[model samples]
Target: MSINHDPKALQNPMHVRVAAAFRIVELSDFEARVLSKGYVSREDYDEAYLLYAEKMTAAGFRVEHLLNSQGYYVPNFSSAARDALVAKGDPAEEVAKFESEQWTTIQNCELGTFRLVNAIFHEQSQPSGQFDS
Candidate 1:
């Protein structure tokens, strides 16, 4: 038996491109400032996470990427993502928890990156780089 792993078997190319574009929206100055702190509590982190996620959703990225709850920050998995994981034989509850945890980790990374970028900027009086428009 052979498994078909063709690229065409995946999502529509246009859909993929649109998704990529939405995810690539540049961080606004305010959002950048909020995440630039060296240390923030989970509560603070969630605030920034939701802010970024809201921007992404408004820009047309899937809403599934955002947290489903204000207090808990649970990740919202799209039906397609959930179905795919189940099809791979993973238990549904476990998969949901895993995905939610993964999103939390991703939020941590986002905050870290903001701090990192600020660190780089602070390392030199004059950081010089050109951003592509």
Candidate 2:
């Protein structure tokens, strides 16, 4: 069977959004399938998610500073936006929270997670005394 027959081709809305945002009309079958599922796979999700991050970053919007309380699902920050918020006498606590959250997200993106290696420990120690054998 050809990849064209895959059930998860990018839906209309997703295809439009992705195409507009990424500036590309063509996508590999795997990519279309991945985006259509709304981020089910880690690698695929990261690719799209990072694109969002890159666009926002380029626009001078801090992708991590958006707050849920402020009615933003995705984190976003900009110098202009911050200034406007601060002019309204924004609460210090909320600003701090946003910054903290943004920092955490940045760190996670910068340093990806890894699985720990499994190993066995032996309770063997070399003799401290002179090895006269």
Candidate 3:
């Protein structure tokens, strides 16, 4: 059975650029579309996990990352980051510290960072990165 379309290309490594050098979680379809198209609005970030998953899957994306219902990345840390990474303590406080520290590279303030963190967590969990938590 030969298909005329290249499905994998739709979610190629180029998309990793968004996940690299930052911690991010996959976004809602609304978020993914707006973000992929380079538009950041005051959108409510509304949408459920299933919807986000299905949208990305339909787009031919693997959708490795997942955000909690509250829109928080699970938490990704390395041995190097262990000392700096917030301990498994208060989620709010740790998130605040991370936001204050890496806002620029992470893109926006807390919101952008949280998204990044979640996405990165999902990606890094796949293979490399020898750092330990």
lDDT of 2: 0.41
Candidate 1's TM-score reads 0.27
Local distance difference test values of all predictions, in order: 0.42, 0.41, 0.39
Q: Tens-digit lDDT track for model 2 on 1-133?
A: 3434222244434334434443444544544454454333445444545555665576455656332453222434555555666788889987777667655655444321110000000001222222122
RMSD vs true structure, all candidates: 16.8, 18.4, 16.0
What TM-score would every model get versus the actual structure?
0.27, 0.30, 0.21
When 1 and 2 are scored with TM-score, the better candidate is 2
**By lDDT: ranked, best first:** 1, 2, 3
- Alpha-carbon lDDT of model 3: 0.39
Error of 2 at 37 (Å): 9.9
List candidate 1 segments past 4 Å from native: 1-37, 65-133
Better of 1 and 2 by lDDT: 1
> What C-alpha root-mean-square deviation, in Å, does candidate 1 show against the real structure?
16.8
Among all windows of ten consecutive residues in candidate 2, which has the lowest summed lDDT? Answer: 115-124
Candidate 1's displacement at residue 31, Å, is: 5.6
Q: What is the model-wide C-alpha lDDT for candidate 1?
A: 0.42
Considering TM-score, which of the candidate structures 1 and 3 is the better prediction for this target?
1
All candidates in order of TM-score, best leading: 2, 1, 3
Candidate 3 structure quality by residue, lDDT tens digits, 1-133: 3221221222334334544443334443334443453323323232323344444344333445544675543332122232345566547777677645543422332333235333433444443443222
